[model samples]
Target: MASSFSASWLRGDPRALEFLSDRFRHRAARAEAVAAAASRPLAPALHEVLVARNARLAPSPARERNLELLARPGTTAVVTGQQVGLFLGPLFTVYKAASAIAAARALAEETGRPCVPVFWLQTEDHDLPEIDHCFVPRNAGGPLRVALELPDAATSRAPVAHRHLGPSITGALAALRAELSGNPHADEHLALLERAYRPEATLVEAFADVLSSLFADEGLVFLDPRDPRLAPLAAPIHRRAIEEAAAICSKLAERGQALAQAGFSEQVHIRPGAPLNFFSPGGPEGARYRLDPTSTPGTWSLVGHPEGASVTTAELLSWLEREPLRFTTSALLRPILQDTWLPTAAYVGGPGEIAYFAQLAPLYAHAGLPMPLVVPRARFRVIDDRARRLLDKLGLSPDDANAPRDELLARLAARDAGEAFETPEAVEARLVSAFASELARLGERMAAIDPTFAQAISRTDKTVRRGVSRLAARYGRSITQRDQTTLERVERLRAYLAPDGAPQERIHALPYYASRLGSHAFLRLVREACEPFSGNLKDLKP
Candidate 1:
């Protein structure tokens, strides 16, 4: 089906178009040119670690089959990832997974090679505030942002994966249940959430459990980098980053400068003498610190806590070998580590990721890994019957919903005033034209007589125009007050379209829709509606 949505932003965003076609040129290459680049298959030991991780999550038959496929000689993965979020974060999370699956299936069909879809759970991310909250509209109006917070006693700068949901999750779930109580599938959605977000469950486990249940049949594999078993596999990449810290830093600095010169901002900055890897000062339970080189050659200290301890190059290597899990790649180096661990054919991400990849072309080359084809994930805007009726009542298109609340209301009020109210605007335009012509004739006559007199005529014309503009503003305000009901309808439409001045997909939680539409039905709607490599915003109607 054709998408019901339109995104004018896509027309002008060069990065979005670049990701869609996988080319700097307008046209894409043929099938043969698009063939997957050969990379070494996953080693048996690494494959076992992946399988064990999936087994812990209660893998489906399809996931098991995909895990088996990973062991094959030529199989490569089409990968995407996000932070473990509340109720799977925003709708874009689902869209990203669907995009990866679509891209993988298309690649498999085109090349006749096994290409599996994988979602790397960003369990190592320590930023708790980012994933702690999700927005859900209560009663189809303004959104309520529900936050699941860690307790003061338990709070630390540790990775979110290790943080338990705790008692606060109960209140958060209750809030969601109350908001979603009226729908037929409300119980089912709440049950799924409760099961995944139990008080004792860690954030990473909850995210995996929920996603596996949602997309089990699609054969999407989930990978957690924090899985201790995979730490050994990541050791080589980690070591190289530390050993070549100075060179990597220099390269990143040069590339960041080049990007700025080219009129694009660098997403990740390079800190001089800082290692591309983060070092956990207190081991697994401690906060992570950036490794910075010390004044002594071949020695380094943590960026913020330099007085804590200094490690020579030899000592750093020993620490990596003994405690591989303690070392994590910086944002700039994470993609390199991902490609190292998985034979990735393409890495699917949003627009911001695509821009950063432009800066990392040099780093990919330095790592001796081919830069995977970067593809834009699908974008969606979900619309229920209530929102549809509101749009129709307001004489607004889906695209019109993007306007600010005040702007949309003003436009609606003007339309409600009809042509009778607009007659004054027409008359004002004619008056302005007549006055312009008369002033020009007067100015010509005055200039012919005395050059300075023309300046006086111009000033008089400006004063007259200012008076007319003020009068027009007053007329518009009066018309708007007369059509106050239309303004109220526009307000309701704005709530659905752009809550808090942001798109619905960026704000609303997944369960909000699961309640409006049945859970299974909503999943099917997203899966079937998404098109491979189509970056346009889709409007999903229920």
Candidate 2:
């Protein structure tokens, strides 16, 4: 949620978020953005890239209409994206899309202009390890991490888009088969995964197909920046980033100073002369090399590969013109490329993006690009009906179940023992309280009869109290043992809802829940739970 935590990204600054959050201010920005967008004009062929890509992945009438809406001069976009992740990566990927759709719908209503939700499929990123694996929830222990153990994956250093699923996928699929329930929904999801993640399917194809299977019908449009057609349109921005490397880097450093002054750190730190770009000399299967300026003016060298030749500014631009798809933006400049090509009114992102966007205000101003409104993706902890029932029976709320394993178990033990039988603490308290009162009356009588006998009464009371405490302690284990089903139920709740002591949404993948709860349940739950800009982590029982 954009609560105070998001404000910390800007700390002393609230103007931009405030402006976008307010209807009156948003209308003004929308009008201004429309005019500015008209003046700059994106290439006309942008829609063609989306249409062709979706035709292959997942296409629907709603998605086609949204693409048409986005192609128009006045229509704006609500954009969010992540790398083509394995099995949809974490649940926040789903959350990011849901929030974008909600924001797009809200922005359309508020601005009275057509708006579409666009998920930028980051097919160009070469971070294979980051998107190589995903966690699967188990009924016992916790979530199991299933990774495609392709032997070449580590050494390739190539983009996942270039890496096709290998025979190792069989083992990963086998893990899924062993772990997931044999219900009808589980069988269908398994079939879908098998179809999508075959040995020949590129990671990009598999990721796109599975995600499309889930959300394409909702009119969420996909844009792969790696599309060769988009390379030329984005080349200018890439050129500017490279051509003005020194000035841009200088401006970024100054912006870092400003952010530091405002209680934040620079999200991206390019060394003094490194441009905010990467060069992939080897093309699709090749490793991406960082673009850093050589000591000589107008000349640059690839940072990692020693054998790669240095190129002058003119040569790089010429190369970029010929093969723009070979170059891509660093995290800091990705939003610039996205907003430049699309009529983006607002961009929904998670916490990390929010922090980095704060560092980009100066960069955007330097590039003369209007910074889109940044909204935090909706956060949630999806609780199933089973977890809900367990929470109810154990007298522990979902929040309590989210506690650390040991702490939650201890509380559950105390609670279950107290209710079903009696915890040692409870028994001791009861025995002490019961005897203290009678002891006080008897002691008073003895003291009145003989003042010397008062000491004996006190000693006797102490002895009785000690004996009660000992007895309670000696039987505490037996009391906990009598918990029967309560402890097991609590463990099940922990494994599902708070695996590894983390929120389920952060730990478990969509496949885990989709198998148990149908995919439709996810679509409906996300749609219903979203409160446009509320930005809260809510609990929803599906």
Candidate 3:
């Protein structure tokens, strides 16, 4: 799960760590101190929106108490969120929430002040393809992609809140039923999904329902940014963003450059003449539109239209008053908006998110918001018992399983019963070396007779090397194909631990494990596995 940027920051590349507020600490004492001093009044509208949402869900005394604390004065939040993915998208989604909950608990204990966990629902995101699928593990030991296929769903630009799960969900469920046919927990979990993801429920609603069910006892508040009531609370920030739009864009570009100089790459692209926000027309079908500055003073052009309409700044500000939810922050601006309005002690993020924060690090000061501690979420390289046994039988490490399917199988097959699987590689190396030496001697002799003949010698040498490599690869594959036992073990090992060369936590869904462990046990394991403030990924049973 580590990107070059994330590995730099998380593994303590000192230059990379400089972008953060604090580092090298296993406790939230310093962050708690900052949050204690950074007291701000709650966004008046959010309390009602959050409390109402929580009331509609299953009863959890712990969650109920967290909700109460969130409404009280001087309560700080430890927030993390994801796009409303089907069945909670990837496993990291759960890891993110667990990290936030862990950070919140540490903060409350450290400061003796109220702190609560909040999961912001990114319902405004319009990329349907990103959230339409969930990977279920098969009985034979591999991933099964259970996706809802709606032709319109793929082509539409509408936000997830508008994507009603209609009849297409039945197809996805049927596919899931087939995958989980022999699973014992299938009846209970599928029934839970059927109830949550009904024909009438929007994608966001179903995601919230399932996620809330899992974390019912954990008290993670789900906040919808599109809630009409909260628009007024966000108005001042929106206005300031519009008025100082160019300046903010300039600051972001400069920060992106600074990140590059520090040996890191920018995660969010900063465009010239574009501000840190998007404009939606405020309807179920309206797509999120990008706004660009016009040459005329205080006028702007909406980028989505083929023929852009020039609207004055006054007109844009009016939308904030009448339909303020029309305006939402960009990837970089969202942290500012969240931290400014909510008393955030820390923000739990994965590698990519943390890398983005580095690009927008200085923007907090530009927006006049108190920067929250950006904590790297605890990571796991999940492996089941079956995968463990295969790895041992093949004498391969967990890291070795991350290679591509054919290459990894080739490696394991080479170590199988006979030298047949490895003979081609030895033959290839010897042939290439001998051919290169002969080619060099031939080239020298030809150069003495005619300088042009040296080029032919070089070309022949290159062709010979390429042909041998392909033959060796094909030979190894053929050998592996003949050994059905090795093939099966390699498939089982790679499929469970590193599907498509990514960790299981990233490729598989919560139910992939929960179906095996049961909800209560899975949740308990997640809570216990959360190594808050410890910037490291470790092996765990759950």
Q: Give per-model TM-scores.
A: 0.85, 0.81, 0.92
- What lDDT score is found at residue 381 in candidate 2? 87
lDDT (Cα, tens digit) per residue for candidate 1, span 252-370: 88877765554456667778967788877678657777778888999888766536776788887887899888877777788998988888878888766766676677788799887
Residue 307, model 2, lDDT? 89
Residue pairs with backbone atoms closer than 3 Å in model 2 (clashes): 1-535
lDDT against the true structure, each candidate = 0.77, 0.75, 0.77
> Compared with the true structure, what per-residue lDDT tens digits does model 2 show for residues 1-542?
12332555333345434322322134576555544544444457888788788888765788888877766777788889988777888898889999999988887886677778889888767777778788986666667998888665655655566778888788888888788866457887888788898888888888888887777667888888877778888888988888778888888788777655555556567578788888777774577777778778888888767586776888778779788877878898888888888877778887677767766777788888877777678889877776777777777777887776544554567664556655566778998998999888887788768888878878998899889978886666555455657667767888877776776777778887778877777667888899776667888777
lDDT of 1 at 186: 93
Cα deviation at 135, candidate 1, in Å, is 0.5
Q: Tell me the tens digit of each residue's lDDT in model 3 across 200-269.
A: 8988889888888888888888887776667777778788888888887888888877777777677888
Task: Kindly give the number of clashing pairs for every candidate.
Answer: 0, 1, 0
Global Cα RMSD, each model: 5.1, 8.9, 2.7
Model 1 spans with C-alpha error above 4 angstroms: 1-21, 24-38, 151-156, 294-296, 299-301, 304-314, 420-484
